[model samples]
Target: MTQTASMSQNGARGLVRGGALDVLRFVAALFIVLYHVAERAPVSLFALHPALSRGYLGTDFFLMLSGYVLARTYGERVLSGGVGTGEFLKRRMLRIWPAHLVMLVVFVAFVLGTAAIGLAPQNPQWFQWSQLLPQVFLVQAWFVPGISGWNMPTWTLSALIVCYAGFPAAWRLTAKVRSPWTTLAVGVAIFLAVDYAALAATGIPGHQLPLRFGLVRGIPLFVLGMLVARMPTTIPSRLADGLAIAAGLGVFALQALGRFDHASLALLSLLIYAAGASGAKGSAWASLAGRLSFSLFLTNQLVAVVWFGAQRAAAARFGFDATMLWLTWALALPACVAGAWLFERLVDTPLQAWIKRWSRREAAVPAPASEPIAA
Candidate 1:
């Protein structure tokens, strides 16, 4: 039986529930939040701690994890036609779009409210009207010019949309390659080819592809993830644990040494595989954190905009000290976490539930009979 059938037989618990992957998801989300905060903080956190500069690797990890998770969950169904492509895309959109649209609206309101109060944003170019349409359609990352204004991180969403659209074909192609080693080889080759082409053309590595063309960066990492999912997990749990530890340490060591090379990517991939294979069923807290990871990621930018804007205004009014400024910047992290929890509970959950209900109703209703055309 396939994994999906097994899931159905076992109450739909999913393959990676309450696992190390969940903890990693939460950690990745937090690091991404920190990276953004470090970028915009007034005191320059990177100077004090250069490791914060490596937070962008969270995104790389996420792209790969997404591929792996989707492959494990849906690859068999997709390959066997148990889930049609259209239905799969619909499911993906439902998962991602609600939170994304909510964030987009919040950002729009933020920009308009700031304008109404005669307050100019620190970066006015990021709030341009020209970019709104692409953002609304979630196509901002598809070769669109100019910086991703509004919520900057939503560019990942745009890239992921393209990945989802192509996933059926990617799954089929990867499934055809029986040898996991050969699959890994193909994925690495694609990643290196894209990396080299990006370097040659734009002086940027594949992993650092600009927001306007994020699909270039997203696709290979996603494929790599799918390939990783195909690999056997026959090692002992203790061995998996050791490899995970080493890979995690390796990633940090490379970052500490200011090296962002293929070695780091290799370590990340190893870390993911080892963590998954360790069979560590995490606690409820870890599962909750995993559930909140998406919201944390989607809301961090908006939280930053509001949190820092208010901090700036307060500092200008009250003349904050260095200690006070740092305190407020530190506070933004938890504020982001709280905001994500609230958004997920209040907005995304309710909206998705309603969409699901409406979809069920639509499915229940019968279609009108077709009339015969005039001869």
Candidate 2:
């Protein structure tokens, strides 16, 4: 890294450590990979233990994380009315789309290769062209997921898109509310209550609303994150670190025990916002980890899933207890770190430049100081 970028990161090191929240983000992504990983194994490592059920909560942490960033980055923008819905979406799309397009193509290619080699399972049900098209669109979740298009974690991207779509409307409603705290409270209560009530009415078995492209399930959590960011005073560093640690344990422990009840999740969400409010002083690793976290979250699962497939094949071919699978996951950590680094460099770093250009084009840019005319 260049000295400037390094220093920028160093400055951020204190500011962005997600504390436990950041750790939870990376861990959440890894846990999702593990859930899939265990599923591909002869026996689930998680099933042997009761705590493995927490894999479903990755999206919950995501909601918390989203809330934090929204408040940190854009909370005030809502009232000031500078960032319009379209511009906000444009930035979001730029961040997500480039990699998403590549990832989508890669999956499609994998499916095709599997089919060509006769390795594709004859589930007739799992493989279909109709589903592939929409999966490419990242809109497949709007309909049912066919086995052929079964990218389980990609649903996060789809659901986030829904949340982004709803944010403008939600902002209007929340902004009109008299108090920021009241806005946050009503939003959280409405989502949880309405979601749970609807789940009860529909006889849905679990607390998570339908796992696909779901706005209703996510918006409240996003709002809570923003509320944390909007707090009048920055959280003290020492306290932030403590909450950061607590957030990680909270998510991990809940997941370990196979619990994500409304109460547990409510607590979890509070910790997430708190960590964000705390900001930089939390912990060293957390700040570093959180810095590249979004990149890590988006890319790690694909690597893990791809590695999982390769390991499954290699294991089947070589007759192993998925020993290679272990090796792949082991290797994947560094690979994921490296990928995140590159993504931060190529995709994320460009955000500032993009924002500058966007600002220049929309708002007036300060003129350069006139050069002294040399005689």
Best by lDDT: 1
The clash count for each model shown is 0, 7
Clashing pairs in 1: none
**Model 2 alpha-carbon miss at residue 332, Å:** 5.6
The Cα local distance difference test for each model comes to 0.83, 0.60
True-structure lDDT of candidate 1:
0.83
Writing each residue's lDDT as its tens digit, candidate 1 over 1-375 gives: 012213322233335566788888899999889988896676677887777777767898999988888887887678888887778888899888877888889888988888898988888888899999998989998999887788888888899888888888888987788898998998999999999999999998889887888899898999899889877766677998899999999998988888667888889899988876775655778778888898898888888888999999999999999889888999999999999999888987788889889989987776667853211
- The true-versus-predicted C-alpha distance at residue 220 of model 1, in Å, is 0.8
Q: Which portions of model 2 show Cα errors greater than 4 Å? A: 1-22, 121-127, 143-150, 205-207, 231-235, 255-260, 279-288, 321-375
Residue-wise lDDT of candidate 2 within 1-375, one digit each (tens)?
Answer: 001111121132222443555666766666665555555555666668766655556666677667666545554565578677777777676667666666566656777887797776433454467766665666654645444344445656665676777676666666676676776677567666766776777765233656543444555566666555444334565776687667657766765565556656666666665655454435667656666766776666556556666666776788765565566656656666677677667866676567558867865644557953211
Error of 2 at 365 (Å): 14
Best by TM-score: 1
TM-score of each: 0.92, 0.76
